[model samples]
Target: MDEAGLSRRGLLGLAIGAGAAGLAVGAGAGTAAGVAVGRAREREDAESAYAFFGAHQAGITTPVQDHLHFAAFDMMARTTRDDLVSLLQDWSYAASRMTQGLEVSATGAVDGSPEAPPDDTGEALGLPASGLTITFGFGPTLFETVEGEDRYAIAALRPRALERLPAFLGDDLDPAASGGDLCIQVCADDPQVAVHAIRNLSRIAFGRARIRWSQLGFGRTSRTTAAQSTPRNLFGYKDGTANILANDAASLDEHVWVAASDEPAWLAGGTYLVARKVAMLIETWDRVRLSEQDAIIGRSKGEGAPLSGGTEYTEPDFATTDANGAPAIDPNSHVRLAHPEHNGGIRILRRGYNYVDGNNELGRLAAGLFFLSFQRTPESFIRLQRSLSTDLMAEYIRHVGSGVWAIPPGARDGSFVGAGLFA
Candidate 1:
């Protein structure tokens, strides 16, 4: 948060230019130097190598990228506290370089001696960063495993709000795709870039940790900035039409970021992340009547306007009724149930994506919404989810995988993410 609006952790969408003096990149961080040079290579690219050109935006609120590769990891059994710390340090260093459009290290991919293995995976060699952002999170299991083993000895430092999400009404959660000790969310415009990030980071994790479960997503279902239009979900309805925009500082502070006055002093400025893998019954939903579909969601299929009347951005007038005097929006409609007006003014910043994992044995597309949301406290999500238990739309979807994590604040130059927990 410097005067030029460049904070290493905050500006994932924009690389700081050559004039950023006193940058604390480590030895051989030609990575940072290369980023500055790469942007200046062309005047037009220099103008907009990443989103927003030169704005002070954090990764969570950065304009939503087109693809996502999210992976959750479990620390290896018997690994000590030092192993965890070193793993994070290595990850932070690698993430910092990769986001700047460089390889995992200064002598990465192919620059090394032929006698040795290259430092990078090499698939993304010719690609730009693609506006990449790698965000890390620590799950409740990271603090203490199910067997009560506190391998990292940092369990005491875990935030009170960082716990597993309670099972919702329609949850059919699969253990294989559920919990993790740590998670990394990689987003970029190119699907390969997103895949490359997870591949390289997983290679870096080698033995200290391993991916417990992973998901690949495309066609983002939400937008984080006003410049971007709302996207549609697999249900063919506009999603995230009322998302918390990056410019909404008031809502961000009140509903997304953790405050200094909150408990677990180490996590100030950080936020809570909730991820749910919602599987849709596409065939069943398609067979339903069109008007019935609109009624279930409480929004117009095309314009995404509230059924109660007005455009996408217009606030719904839930009290409005039809010619017969029935409620314009069904009490069981999704929009009404999840709206802040119904949930004590609660809202979560969504950064979800539509996912299709090929076809299943029955020939139905194995697809769903990989839902990701950030909130100041887990309760914001919990309350809204509780209210959605009666949603009519719930009949066509199932929650199959779920997790919650404590997102640490942005790291400073020369510091690894979550450095405060160790302190």
Candidate 2:
């Protein structure tokens, strides 16, 4: 431990409170040789990097990455308020470096002492940035536990809308995975890169916080930009056909980003994230007839166009009629139920993924859609979810796990995530 009683790694975390690359900003790394070495290391790994410090976090509005490692954490019992602050500081510093394609510390994996453990886990050595982004959030429990204990004594600062999500219809929710004190959403083009980020961040949390539940997701289920083609979910249907795009600033302001006028001023620039682990009964759904499936989803399986429509992007004609004079789009179809038109123009930005977690004892695949959506207020998601209670697709799926977290605004150059809460 250091003079301040901080461990070796913890001190390194504090030292880089500013940018890790700022090591040479003032003294130029002590010598020209040292400066060249630092630059060389940066150039080797800084490919496809995203800025970690921003007005809003990177992972949310940034083009969705191909892989995700979403982990929920609970603060360890009896930890002090200072412990929480320091942990966030350490996490922020480490995250800033990792997002820039640097190791968790200046002296990384191999450079540490032979007798002691390395600062970094070493799995990501020599790897490019891979467009990595790490987003952190504060779950409702972080402020006040279910039993009403304000462990950290910041309960008053908790936003009024940051309470636990209410139970919805058709929920088979697992208590073990439903709630957490904190959450981190890590995403990258390379699956290893995504996992590496969460693993390292968890290590940094150490005694202060422990992961409550985590999910590994592959094959992005939603597209965030026009450049990305619509991806299929485990149900084999093109999903997120009309999702809020990253470039729609007007829509983002209206539906996704929380406005300054909102309550709990600390969360003004941030948004709420709602996650649902919707398990698709793959074996049972496979036996479904094609025409019936089309009617269920209200879209053609091949083209993904609305049954009442022109093309994939054509607006759905909810009022259109069939030859027999019935609505072309089924009244209870997934598309119609989830559409913004039917829900008082409410919309959310989705960044979901498909996952297959091996088979169950009955020889059935344990696979599902790890649904994620960002909304300006928790009510936006709550209202939409309630509207989908009557959706026909509910027959083949079960919501096995769920959570809601208030994502704090991104850190400043020398600040930590959630620092505003303490301020």
- In terms of lDDT, the best-performing candidate is 2
Tens digits of per-residue lDDT for model 1 on 195-279?
9989999999998999999999999999999899999999999999999998999999999988899978878878888999999
The lDDT values for all models are 0.85, 0.88
Instruction: Please give the lDDT score at residue 34 for candidate 1.
Output: 48
Query: Using Cα atoms with residue i matched to residue i, what is each candidate's TM-score against the true structure?
Result: 0.88, 0.89
What TM-score does prediction 2 earn? 0.89
Position 49, candidate 2: lDDT = 93
What would the C-alpha RMSD of candidate 2 be, to one decimal place?
11.1
Best by TM-score: 2
For model 1, name the residue pairs that clash.
none
- Which sections of candidate 2 miss by over 4 Å? 1-46
Off by over 4 Å in 1: 1-58
lDDT of 2 by residue, 165-238 (tens): 88898899998978899999999877777898899999989999999999999989889999999999988899
